[model samples]
Target: MISSRSFVAISFAVVPFVFFACAKGSSLPGGGGGAGGEGGDEWSGPAQSSSSSGGMGGSGGMGASSSSASSGASSSSGGSGGGGSGPLPIVLLRIGDGVTTLSSAAAPVSLEWRLTDGSATPGAPGTTSMPQVISGSNYQLTLSGTASSEGHLSLSANGKYVFLAGYAADVGTLNVSTQIVSRVVGRVDASGNVNTSTLLTGAFNGSNVRGATSSDGTSIWVSGNSTTTGGIHYTTLGSSSPTQILSNPLNTRCVHASGGQLYATSGAGTFVNVFTVGAGLPTSTGQTATSLPGLPTLGASPYGFVVLDLSAAIAGPDTLYVADDRSPANGGGIQKWTFDGASWSLAATWNDGTAGVRGLAATPWGGGVRIVATTAENNENRVLTLFDDGSAFPEIVIATIAPLNTVFRGVAFAPQ
Candidate 1:
């Protein structure tokens, strides 16, 4: 549970950038569009939801229990009892007030959760893990579609709503749910009723959107691709149509915002495109994009990027981490670049010595920063690996594990 003091602190912390962004699209990734993934080439921010329903069990609760089923499970997201059991795999992890939620995707559907026990880390000492039954509580809500390949459950700093990504061959889904209890004690009895889910729009809406990210929790920034007619569009949550910002047709992939200035990755091949937010895409949206000039000889082409404030930087304003998955033949690695507002130069390039590193995020753990990446053969059978910042070139693995059986596609992390 977030004490009043913590809530006030987080809100004050966000005051600096609250006015920098102008929301344009339908409901942000989260109901109110909770923020995540900020910076150029990054996802901008995480899902922010605004609905408040109490903690895991009720007001002042201490744990959260949630399950993202594969395709078709049960009405209540929590798995039922009477199945083979063994060591539970920690699927989804999120840090919320007094409660933390973890999912076990394997075996006879089950949700094992633990009370915070006042430990900052719920899975750590003095905590206890208990099985949450599907029919036991009114707070648990079952996901109807396939679990997200990204395997993340984003909770707002306020702990009002939960956001997750789910995708299928023909169906890709995103969700925002209310957290009614502290832990997944079991399924909320059917009679214990509550409206727990609200669906977000899909990528395959056939609307010519190339790439997109939630600018806030309620508005979406969708880029236009070769097939899309609208260059970029913004819609408010619950709105029926999008407001067009540009109409040029370009193969836009990456999207990020640094003030009112929006940046994208464009070009026939691969490049970074810069644009003014709410104005339109760059004039060179057709074929050219700003180049990083001094990038070291990275083996793979840079696929994605995120900007972070390295409190360790001597002079640079921010550091850029790019997913440079050289070719499979050459082995891929993530490269770092330093930016001082005007000039950008390479900082450190670490090769994982394996294949490639994609789905990168700057994770805050153990009071420090950890660079996380998902590695696999074309994103399949993926595993997440964590490394400390400024520790090495590629990354030094501290923890590694498989998230889903399918190819791991994307990864996102909320404040632990």
Candidate 2:
């Protein structure tokens, strides 16, 4: 339900923070990291492994196949992963307001993470049983408002961090706006451990929470809702204050701060855009921004995306994977675009029936890439894994989450 003028909103369960629900069959649409060791223990689940031993192949265009293949495939993940016996990959996910981890692999899909706390509400809860300041901060947002909570991989001045961006809303009626009670950001280690007390004091119902840093991980550019900018902002380590950065064509959908560059999804006009930052990503605000060349001007609702560069040079990435939530006719699905010496081209589209995708993550495999994504805006949303070798293959279901009344949002690679 998008209009030329404004992005529509829908209240979810007791949490009235407007849920960013993209149309299942409709379309256009629209983040990163922080300190390390700030997260404490609070995880429980089976880890998925993505080894490149054997997989299936098919012929032709982007049409997908669900038929099973032999063991040894791939899963969704992060970092410049190539050869085998590498770092055990970690997949970061935003299930509700809280975040969790999945050990990624190439074979049988990982099992769905379910609530063992025994709350009557299994999926999205009306009143959260999670802590309140939350109480202990060691718990997951299991029985709570289910919405698009964006998670990103970032770095502190010292180490890598996973940024969990989300907010808690006061009890209210569905479809009716309510007061936003808490805007919070959780920091974690690569293993999904809570690192610090979450905090965010603005009106932003953060769609993407990320930060840009040089190899040093300081003087950064951050993303999310701000009281002043309403889009991307700038912040640093050891402090909670954020300065307004980008103002025009404001985007709160999702953002990525990497390699002295800022990439974000700016809605229907352009699928993805970028902003330039000073080297070292200096602590100051004030920077120049612009829409990227060759991206579609309309008909794409992109959520999570990965801009990857495997070349030896530090130039702009050559591979781009955008999570578009529109139907196949309207350009919905996981759109794979490749950059030549110049312009970008649509390489492929992966889908699950008519349903579209929202959150996403990827890493290099045996000369190919392993991708994991969440289905969106339908009664049958899911968290899935795919092994892409430029061929047609069956999509592996990690979990059919709609039955839990829950929806998955932003996803990222944990610090490797």
Candidate 3:
């Protein structure tokens, strides 16, 4: 469980760019709209709702332990249903996040998710997608729907889940900028089941949320880029909507929580920012984020990322992996950097193929790391797995999994 913090709510610089990289070539798997994927202050932000009757109202205190059911996106979006009796597989894919069209009808669909593996449980295609297994919490959330495209995902600090910031597709269009944009936070488990999820809706007045991350498994911080009221939205499991905790940095895209430290990609400057996590996401709205030092000026295209620690006794993370959706020529591809307590250095760059890689996840391998990634948006997009070792590559391609109309978005892989 996460403890609450006080926020003062500072004015975050509005992201002038509504990153809808639907440009000519590389873009988000061809669907809804998302471009590049920012925060501030003491505990001052949006006030919580006062509803008491929970089912799906706004105050969040109620949780319904219902069986996982089939949503409209079941046929097209990814899903979670396997009974994790034995060792669970790695990789979680966020299929349709509602905004994208799956059926020929171009109808809005619910959020969908799928759990498979890079090689162990091998799927024709993959996502959250990776081969290496990580250990985190003990619960999960199962999803089903047709999300044209959705945001990226992250595993909890302990590793058992893929934290997700999703819209409730059963109701309205989650175009955070122009609509009420109902969002939900999830803990996708090993059996591909989200045991307890957080619902952020009812009175949310934010915009363009794209990524989610958690320190423990109870609370989540969602990041996005909006021209107006968009920044860091927070909520606990089973809650309704969320409170905007900080608003300083602009165009906050993807977020990750590692080793008690909170890190995120900033669209405003195409760089990464770090926040000191005190139990949950920083509560003081006045809290300021520091730019991650030692990067080679990532000029946009920086999507989802992962930070891994080689040793717990070491105090901080030593290895970092960042996903840039631009072509190698334009600084696109997967970047592997190593950190020495004080600074980071270019360890290597992987951009052999797959146009440009977007969202990525990694696990410790032999002497290196095993990585899984989703290619930059393309009609023939793919889920790929390559190894630092303990894996393979021609880059094993996990493709034929989803229905033809579905586009795979965010992915998470955590093993316990």
Candidate 4:
């Protein structure tokens, strides 16, 4: 049950990027820095290798030995130091018009990259354009074994690869009645090159696959909407077969993994479903569905959301932000909630008379957290808005970018 806006078929020209003949015999880049252990060493770049991984190292070529040395330093220093100063982390936005034409000439999904310096203050408005675009022809083919439409995207913890989940129709036909929609999972390396062997294809109850996330490097959790076959599904990094984990009859809009929990929000549910993910998979027991207090009952329309484990921020940890896509005039906005040992309570709310917040992401900024959300405007222009978690009412709109005629679906931060 993909949204009409998300599954619409459109005709548009492809955006161009410098194309390099994909290199041969290239090995995948090492997974980037590990999630820094609690009070242990901070996360560092992957150990460098002697052979070229592929393309421009593009913020991914630091030495592996350097990672080892940094870990040693952290062990000796008792983990007192903060994440070291380095190049800004890369922020990747999944871009697509959702056009699924099977004609010989059809544009595929693409990715745009932005560099965040980790210091943008609240209330400071700025506009930044993404400089790099990786087209579907370049990466999707390698990841999915076919040029399929891209839907939701997630970055692996180590930052080595981006996991994508979406649906694809058979090629060389335009008959909607004859189209076969199938779910696909794929990976792209730091160099923006796709890893062909990692392409995973299957079906999810005859519905377009939607949300996806990877908590650990081994397995990925995906969700879709189908009465018979949809719910939450999972598969390992190298496996094409998927095991349906949760078979609830809900239209899951997005899924995220953080702090040992897997959170999923449905476009038709009042509460966000939570599960304990152990060993990279959700445990079958102890699943809880929670909702924000004081919010009007959302009969069936909770859209995109983000979970912030801001243990590093001065603000209390276990913060969650859910985008309510009701019309902006009817209280459509983001509801901020915090877990107070026992349950989640509303902390704050912010919106500016504009609804359609469909994608959310967070990254470290100014020693705190910067939240980026996509607002789908009525005019079909998608607006990217930034906010500082430390701010109050009218939460600081640090930046906004409206990409022309595109509906931005998901946003992710690639570690520096």
Candidate 5:
């Protein structure tokens, strides 16, 4: 059973207030680059045929729908997608962990990657595997190794490089030689050929990793237990040595950067830690920090969290979405949160049935929102649940997606 003590200990371990004060004390430095051929065998020549020709409207499924549509419509649509000006790139996250096992012995963990068509329907409706063809173009990548734990894959606004975190004892980057096609144009079929390579290494920070991307995709935020100091720290894009943003010796599982702000979860605390970013990003070293209201009471610790700032939505600027995976045995369920332009607070709470939520990702679908989350282990299948802004949770299986030996860890989509 999940214990209250363990929950409380985990939540408060990485207190944001402690880190805000700590962030003021000292500073750390770091830099990053890839080791393969100078940009290696990246797509060099002219543009290949367009990968996505149909457009965003073609890719369907509640997950890829835009957030502007009505929630009722969003909840029922199986293959509807949010319209986009052009094709978008899809980012896949491989989540797993590593350890130096005994010589002649094998590693204890496995590598897994979760694939999401940048705008939903990177494949076809009712199809377990990604569609092989799209607008007379082919898509492929080189992939290797087993995903163990917490890692990241970040996509740019223009979709050039998909930054991957926590892999092969270091961070890696998947540089698409050409523009990524949207699901509407074509779907990604699993050939298990996605390329794998490292970008940064050396005493990397964090454990049970959590990461966030900047609006421009120029920067990212990662929070977790640090390998170098064993304390929780936040790292930015392109930096190997993190700026030790927080270190109360607590273990953090998730980190997010949005709307010029940073948020983190201790998975064992009552408060959602917050940080304010300056012009530099992951580089800013967080000049300021604050706490969000409506965190679980001490007994009901909030473990996993996600944040989305829909400033672009015609709705309002101060809107934020957060989820709390609670164990009644430990005290919570599927919870919701919101933030005005200035302060943050809770919105609603609901039970996601038997299995609780572990991770969350949001995509805009025609005036509404589509969310994907993982449930605690069930039978043979690890439950992947989908939620529309106004409805109950639904099970949407991503069966037969590639890189066989690898498991799906996290999901991310390119901005429309």
Candidate 6:
């Protein structure tokens, strides 16, 4: 059986560091190579081929017919598809005190929202207090402290609500070990206010809810650990209980829902657990875990992932972007995979010795896709990196916002 690892915490310190870049291309301080071989200081080289699995589409009641054909076709054409029109909104996870352990001294986490003008600069910080307001962005308001141990964030399909996953316990003197421990779910209106009362406690299995995503606004799927085992659970917004969808002892780390499918990664190895979500829930009772192609036999630990269903934009197939936190010595980097309505194939990989790649998000920019990633270095310094869709190497080091002595967790782009 795979063992679960505890979350690390960063020391307490407050430093505000923000840098904006407008250049179309800029290299890292040390110029790294591509994704495969060793380089001076940049990423290694492009991706290499790995093992493959038989098509799992038609097994376990998991088939592609349930996905919207029109949406898939539109995405395959590329560019902005269906509802991806307006300016892109950026949502970031800011964890205070950096600790994942339950404690009274733990500071509350916050979700920062800002709109981009297709440039690298983030919208200026709002002057108001708790509910910080971004003057000109679709997310007119920013919020924090609505949930404790909030490790992941996802917006509802309608863009009206934000779903959060993690554990929730009382703050300060009320904190205790016997407090509810589970993969909890919380919801907040997109109108910009952080209302703690809106958070739903004990909504699922009492485990550390590490990842969450919603296909439609009505239902949410969460992945997390419960003592000796980890599982994927589901619950509707405003509900008090979540039903266990799939249970495994693999130490699930993150999850993403797209194109009628749910993708989850495990910290135990390079396997990506895929599920067919039909009618807003898992169609079967188990997962179709597929090992990532092209990854070396050792040092491949998959973390957070994102699914880009360009089938609606380019009329092609859906793409999966996975962040592998393995050290540079073992080929640590980002891995790209393409699904042809069945199994997945290795597409590309990129990394620059900077391990701890956690969260991932992609948005339409300059008529193509722009990918943004978060890297937490030994839980000390957190860096946000950006890469162009088809670039040979990572394009820019957008900003380093973790100077506040906090570790960054999950990130998501506001629904377009």
Best by lDDT: 3
Two-way lDDT contest, 5 vs 6, winner? 6
Residues 1-416 of candidate 4: C-alpha lDDT, one tens digit per residue: 01111112222222222111112001111000111111111111110000100111111111001101110000010110122232233334433233431222212345555432222222221122211223443222211111111244556545565555643432222321112444555555554544323323543443445556665556777765555455667777656676766655334556655545566665444443332233334735333444334433444244456555555433333666665554443434455666765566666544433343555555444344444455543213232333333434222221224233333445555421
TM value for model 4: 0.61
* Rank order (by TM-score, best first): 3, 6, 2, 4, 5, 1
**Superior candidate under lDDT, 3 versus 5:** 3
Residue-wise lDDT of candidate 6 within 1-416, one digit each (tens)?
10112112122222335332221010000001112111111111110001111111110110000011100000010111112133345556655433443233223445555432222224423211122222221111121222222355655544555555534442331322123433345455544444322223443233344556666556777765544334566667655466665665334556656545565665443343333333334734565454434333344555556555555644433666666555533444456666766567656554433353556665444444545455534233443443334533322232345543454556566433
The worst-scoring run of ten residues by lDDT in candidate 1 lies at 14-23
Residue 36 lDDT in candidate 5: 15
The C-alpha lDDT values of all candidates are 0.29, 0.40, 0.44, 0.39, 0.30, 0.41
Clashes of 3: 54
**Superior candidate under TM-score, 1 versus 6:** 6
Candidates in order, TM-scores: namely: 0.46, 0.61, 0.63, 0.61, 0.51, 0.62
lDDT of 3 at 253: 66
lDDT of 1 by residue, 1-416 (tens): 22211111111110100000110110111100011111211121210111111012111211111111111101111111111121111212211111112221211111112111100223422211112223222223222111221222322222222223221111111221111111111111111112212222332122122234443334444443324332444444334344545443233434443223344433223333222343323222332234444443322344334544554545422556655444323424445566765666655444323345444444333333334444433212223232333432211221232222223323333212
Candidate order, lDDT descending: 3, 6, 2, 4, 5, 1
TM-score of 5: 0.51
Q: For model 4, give the RMSD to the true fold.
A: 16.0
RMSD of 1: 17.7
TM-score-best of 5 and 6: 6
Candidate 5's residue-wise lDDT over 181-221, tens digit each? 11010111232222222122322222223333333434444
Clash number for model 5?
49
Instruction: Give me candidate 2's TM-score against the actual structure.
Output: 0.61
